[model samples]
Target: MDDMTVRGRWIRVVATSLCGVLLLVGTLFGADDDFPFGPFRMYATGPDPNGDAKDSRVEGTDITGRTVPITEGNSGIRRAEIEGQEAAYVATPSRLSEVAAAYAEHSPGAAPLQSVRLVVRWVGIRHARPTGTYRDEVIARWTRP
Candidate 1:
């Protein structure tokens, strides 16, 4: 083999081995409750048949007293959008009022939002079928001042 060909093959082998080591280290030591490296716990572990499925959504009451579901497209405020701002939101949930105001401005057809609330609904899933009835829990609320 030519000298250049041998050197190129060694470089490829070293690069592949280095990547494998990185992935192993990251998976072993770089995991958190909400963040995980490759080989997610969800995929590694089996789903609990009796576990409850919970969904969270931000909703609001309009001036007309109608209920409106706040969405990312409408309110431009998604929990997922706050990637690095979870702590900030936990500290001052009233910050959501700013989102409510923006949503009211964009949704002219709908009456202005009178207040906003975070609703968490959960239902038990047994063998992939919804077993228990639905339950709603309002954890947070913010009204326009």
Candidate 2:
């Protein structure tokens, strides 16, 4: 194998140093939007052992008055997408109409939605273990007008 030239060695050193600096800056100032170089805080920290675990889901009341889950298969929208913009949904519950519309477009034969809501299920925990209890909270809701 041929040896790396002095110029090539200098280029590699500069590139490595630049990468290190970028990582440092990203770690200090970047958010989740800046991945790869930035630290992903989502999994970086552990939750409090005794704190409640949250699970969010979307649900809709159909024309038949049956409440059903609005999953990715039915709505083309994932739970994570909803969780990421949860604050906006809570601020303006009317945005849930978009999810209802998405479900209608994706599942043409399904019952039409009468209302959509964002629900959060909080599971009780103790000593980092489940307590076999949970509560559902409606964070936002939109009824067809």
Candidate 3:
């Protein structure tokens, strides 16, 4: 081939390789924070290896003052969604009230919820053995207006 043809082929190869690398790097770092191009990082990282394990669930108090555990099926929302929004809830508690409204609406014939709370019951492990210990933390709560 001519000198110009060889140079053009080499440039095309270099550009293609550069674009591939950029795409891979973007995918590795961008997750659960952006649009359709990246991965869903909701459960990408497991519980901290050094920290205690946690079992998370959402609960709410009804108008009758009885505590009710919200479920994915009943509310069309899941624990993972709750966990995902925990940070935003902590920063702005009013978001919980919006979720509570949805929870109340989803449960037919049940007394509406007065308040919603995200409670986590966690326990530490030692050497991969159960310590027979746990504690509850009320992460966030929002009451209906």
User: Which parts of model 1 have CA positions greater than 4 angstroms off?
Assistant: 1-4, 32-37, 82-90
Candidate 2 local distance difference test against the native: 0.95
In the range 15-78, model 2's lDDT, one tens digit per residue, is 9999999999999998788887788998778999999999999999999999989999999998
Model 2 spans > 4 angstroms off:
none
- Higher-TM-score candidate of 1 and 2: 2
TM-score top scorer: 2
For candidate 2, list the clashing residue pairs, or say none: none
Ranking by TM-score: 2, 1, 3
Q: Using alpha carbons, what is the TM-score of model 1?
A: 0.77
Worst 10 residues of 3 by lDDT: 33-42
Weakest lDDT window of 10 consecutive positions for candidate 2: 30-39
Instruction: Estimate the overall C-alpha local distance difference test score of candidate 1.
Output: 0.74
Per-residue lDDT over 34-111 for candidate 1, one digit per residue giving the tens place of the 0 to 100 score = 344355675667767778787777788988899988887787776676434544545677976876887977776778
Each candidate's TM vs. the true structure? 0.77, 0.93, 0.69
lDDT score at residue 22, model 1, on the 0-100 scale: 69
| Model 3 lDDT tens row, 17-114 | 98777667767776655434455665555555557778888888999999988888768887788887888888887788877777767888989889
